[model samples]
Target chain A: MAMSRAVLEGRAEDTDGRLLLLDPSDNVLVVRARIPAGETIRVGGGVPVPVPADLPLGHKIARRPIAAGEKIVKYGAPIGTATVAIDLGAHVHVHNVKSDYTPTYHLLGGEAGR
Target chain B: MTMRGWLRSDGRKGIRNTVVVGYLVECAHHVAREIALPFREEGVHVIGFPGCYPNAYAERMMERLCTHPNVGAVLLVSLGCESFDKRALERAVRATGRPVETIVIQGTGGTRKSIAAGRAFVAAQRAALDAAPTVPMDVSELVIGTVCGGSDGTSGISGNPAAGRAFDMLVEAGAACIFEETGELIGCEHIMAARAATPELGRELEASVAKAARYYATLGYGSFAAGNAEGGLSTIEEKSMGAYAKSGASPISGLIKPGDLPPRGGLYLLDVVPDGEVRWGFPNINDNAEIAELIACGSHAVLFVTGRGSVVGSAISPVVKICANPETYRRMEDDMDVDAGRIIEGRATLDEVGAEIRDLVIGLAAGGRTRSEELAHQEFVLTYKSFEPIGPACLPAA
Candidate 1:
């Protein structure tokens, strides 16, 4: 079998910043470590983009601009659809992306907008 | 290829020779626990159905568990008034050629009398089981199941995929591997459907996930728990992408319900969610509940991948904990068997971790105890649920 980590291993840093691209088709990068607001982060061999907000680890950040209601691709599959237009380096979370199978419920309050 | 194993008359082999003390109803749980308590040092475990009312699902699960390959004997504790088919269970155990005894609390006078009688029966059975003949077993004869719990952002990247690699190696060696929780596989149905061995099987795979999505939608909540978000997951579909990695790259051979066994050596998916309406609150109440379903389907061992760290093991089967987070593994190293998180930390590769997990499985089957087993983490929880019989298309070979 092909090396397992090679296909799915998340990246912490690659001389750019700690962002992981799970699949080549993915439009978002998983945060390997927490990033401070306004910090410039480079990912997927693309140009560096400045972070709009401080994001926790494991959360996602858009690698590039995405249109409103577009399917958000991660792991080479659609995890959810973008609720509104997402800009590069913007945090992609419940506020921006929502699950297509069922409503995504946030623990703090109500469900995300579908 | 041969390992020391208990050979049953029905032609099943067991890695561990265990005696299960089952309580037929809630009324008999106390006496059953008391009987198995002192023998905890031995391969004795307590299992029961809490409901006094008869349920077909419970009956089948209890029967399959009692006659599981790991069990060498069974002791049934009945309240004498419950509707459980104790006679049928006893008969089933007898057919498997294992020593079985029933102690009716009402007939035995009381709890004290029943406990005394049950203990003596256990002692006799234990002596017989020790003298039971053992035969050589092979890797191809084993059945393994995989499930991920307490998932974090690192799960999909590390532990789950490492487990998938191990699954691939096992399947290639002709072992029956099972991966479940269609509720968690929601958005990836289209991707998973393509991995089915046949076009019909692909349809069955997609339909199963679709059914789970609809059922969870009615419940007003996805299969995702709040802790999932705490660990970096944003939605059930995102968690699924990581969870789906546990299946590795094997072609799904079939789809099965709780008690259905795979016909041959290949990968299979256990449909944990029920067919019709949600009769019992949720498909799986907790992680161990899923482990129970895997056990009922005849899993000899379960590979549990956890990012946030779940320290649970099953009663009849051994659970090998694969930690996805390096930090979590550091805090709970004793509970874990393989450190897939090392891949995320750049200390090891996924193939290396997969090989480590594969070696661990072979070692456990050959009598090496896992950390969970050593710590006595025999967590078992089975709740009420309903399932219709599987169709011919479900298991084409069977």
Candidate 2:
């Protein structure tokens, strides 16, 4: 089965040690490892983009700018829609992207802005 | 790969020649378990229908299990008063030419006398199975099933997709591969339908997920667990999109209910939700129930993918544990077979890990015991449920 290049090479080892664009059409990138604020990381084969906030492992970061109510694309499909505008390199998670099926539940009382 | 297996009268092959001591009801469970305890060193394992009341579904499940490809003989323990049809169970096992004996607890002077008799019956069956004729079985004769438990965010990105890739390889090899849990697959029905071999099969797959969604909604709880949320998943759809990855890219050939064996070798979906009104509490109480269903469907072994890490094997079939989380793998290395989380860490690619899993499954089928089996994790659970018979469309080829 010939899948997209992004699907095939989604786990390709990144020399820069940064994010993963699972699909070429994906709007979000999975953080390969934890990143501190202000660290520049590659996004979607583009120039290095500075990390705007601290990101946790396995969390998603917007590869490109996403407007509020726009669908958040990961694994080449819509996981959810952004609740607010998300800039490139900004974190994407329950605080921003809300599931289309059910309410997103947060464990911690809304304090950290990611 | 060719493996030596027991050739049954029904034209099925068994990888393991196991003798089962089954209890007819909860009252006889203790005696059955005791009988199996002394013989655990051998192939004897305890399995039973705990419910005392008459349920066609339960009886059918037991019948299928007693005649399962892995079982060589059976010793049924009856309380002697329960509505469970011991004679029918005996006939089912007998029809397969496997030795079967039923000891009525009340008639045999209660528990002490029955346990001794059951133990003696099992020893005789073991000796008999040792002398039974065996035949060569091919990979095409193999039926493999997969299920995920303790799923986390990494599951979709790594483990489940790796299992999917393995499923694709197995299906391409002409092996019958089954991936289930329509409840977890609720959100990906559209994509799943697109991969169906037939348009009608696509519709059936969609309807099965819809039924699961309705059943869970009425139960007032999605299948989502607190572990899923802590692992970064927010809703059922997000979790479902990940869970749906285990099916691989094979075109679905059929949809079958529990105990409904796949008619031919290919990819099939197991529709676990009960038909008609929601009489049973939940479609599957836990992962073990689904594993048991897979075993009853004639799977010689099971591939159990986990993220949070579960150390569980089935009563009859061997379970190959594949760990999806690198962190969890580090914590529970002894319990897992495949380290699929390496894909996330760039230690390996999905295709590489997938091949590893495929090889491991083939090896397991050829008589290698998995880590769960070595640890004696023979977990079994059976609950009450109702299922209407499937229509001709369910297994069109059969």
Candidate 3:
């Protein structure tokens, strides 16, 4: 998928027609829209990496292969640490990453609960 | 722009002339609620401290709230046995020259008599407030607050930043602007500190965020909830970054606590986290508690940015809801005052939405009701907390 000029007009960083790079130093990209598994997303004009699962809108996708214990950077800051090794284009979320500052409370089975 | 405002004896201007009925303790909440029930649509609000224990913080908060600029009159309902200092609360309101009356449920022939007395006081005060003289209020005299609740991923790039832009414009126009949630701002302390007006104030800002981090850490939660994760936010710091954007690109004028009002027009950070040890549960149990704190700090109006869609307005002030996610905006359009999600959909730029917010605020000051106000969403909440007086460096001569 080709990135439209309108989407990239005001944005400082480039997107792969699916992911939005909030900051140049970020290690992950925000999903602009929902993306299905096997869809390709290119980072920094590099080789396209196939998404491992269906990525929901506003969720994050890894811009590069991340080792376990490495910091997950977003908005040019370390949001959390990866709990397990994550390949590029893999979803970065609660199941695979955890907060370094405090515990994140989620319901059983990773379902959304207030 | 200038608008007609209810001028208080303290020389403060108010966008809304409200009569607040306060309960000294949970035991008196029923009487207070009944007193304000009939006049709910007439700007009569119910607010109170539920704790029976004597808390200095709660006392100070009550004092500030009762004397708030927006409050034209006050009615205090006491259970006659609670530890809360009802006398001092009444005296504080009286000192503001606002008509204040207190009814003790135990002494005033129990619940029925107290409710009737309280309602009579409120009714008379409400009539008097309608006749109160109005003064011309300038935009520079307004004190505005911003907070984001039920936030999702879209909040950061859209609603929050658009609100930030609005804050920038408000500050530039000489209005006092405040942005808070230190617990959620843990990771951005350094970045925020660098924007402080002075080095000493910067250090104070950093220490405040550190306190929040430590306080939440001790509680074993980072203010992150399952809803945040479900909305695609993974960590507290990630949410913090999004929350931090609401402060806009302005030099930090000062640091303040919940009840501390900004001295002049500029951007200030309200540290909602309590000082010292983490004693009283969460800093703010819910969004309305924070909104109440902002109102206590003399905010004439609050700009609420949300992605998950919160429909709560507030007592004594109006809440302008800015919806972040395009889908959520579509789902809750009637409740929202601004569709900041347009930035996400490429339908509008941040500046356009920001200008719209500023214009709407001016319009609200001129008696234009917000969506929340129109829906009669006068939610209020107060909780226990502790804080020491701010240090010299906190305000930095400003």
Predicted candidate 2 versus true structure: per-residue lDDT over B1-398, tens digit per residue: 55778888899888888998899899999999999998786788888889889988889889999999989999999999999999988987898888899999999999899989998999899999988877877888889999999887778778888998899888998899988999888778999989887788888889999999889888867777766765666567777878888888888898999999988889999988888888779888999999999988889888888887889998888898888888889999999999998887878888998899888887865767789888877788888888877766666553
**Residue pairs in collision within model 3:** none
Docking quality class, candidate 2 = acceptable
Instruction: Give residue B122's lDDT in candidate 3 (0 to 100).
Output: 88
Q: What are the clashing pairs of model 2?
A: none
Model 2, stretches more than 4 Å misplaced? A1-8, A11-16, A34-57, A64-68, A82-91, A95-98, A102-114
- From the highest lDDT down, the ranking of the candidates is 3, 1, 2
| Shift of residue B179 alpha carbon in model 1, Å | 0.6
Give the DockQ-based CAPRI class for model 3: acceptable
Looking at model 2, residue B12 earns an lDDT score of 88
iRMSD, per candidate, in listed order: 3.4, 3.1, 4.6
**Candidate 3 per-residue C-alpha lDDT over B1-398 given as tens digits, one digit per residue, 9 for 90 to 100:** 55879888888898889999999899999889999999989999888999999999899888988888888899999999999988988888888888998898999999999988988888899898898888888899999999999988888878888888899999999999999889889899999999999999999999998999899989888877667787788889899998998998989999988889899889999989988877899999999999988888899999999988889999889999999888898899999999987776778878899899999998887879899988889888888999988888888483
Model 3: runs farther than 4 Å from truth?
A1-15, A36-53, A108-114
Name the lDDT value of residue A85 in candidate 1.
Answer: 98
Name the lDDT of candidate 1. Answer: 0.85
Chain A superposition TM-score per model:
0.76, 0.76, 0.76
Q: Relative to the true interface, what fraction of contacts does candidate 2 keep?
A: 0.22
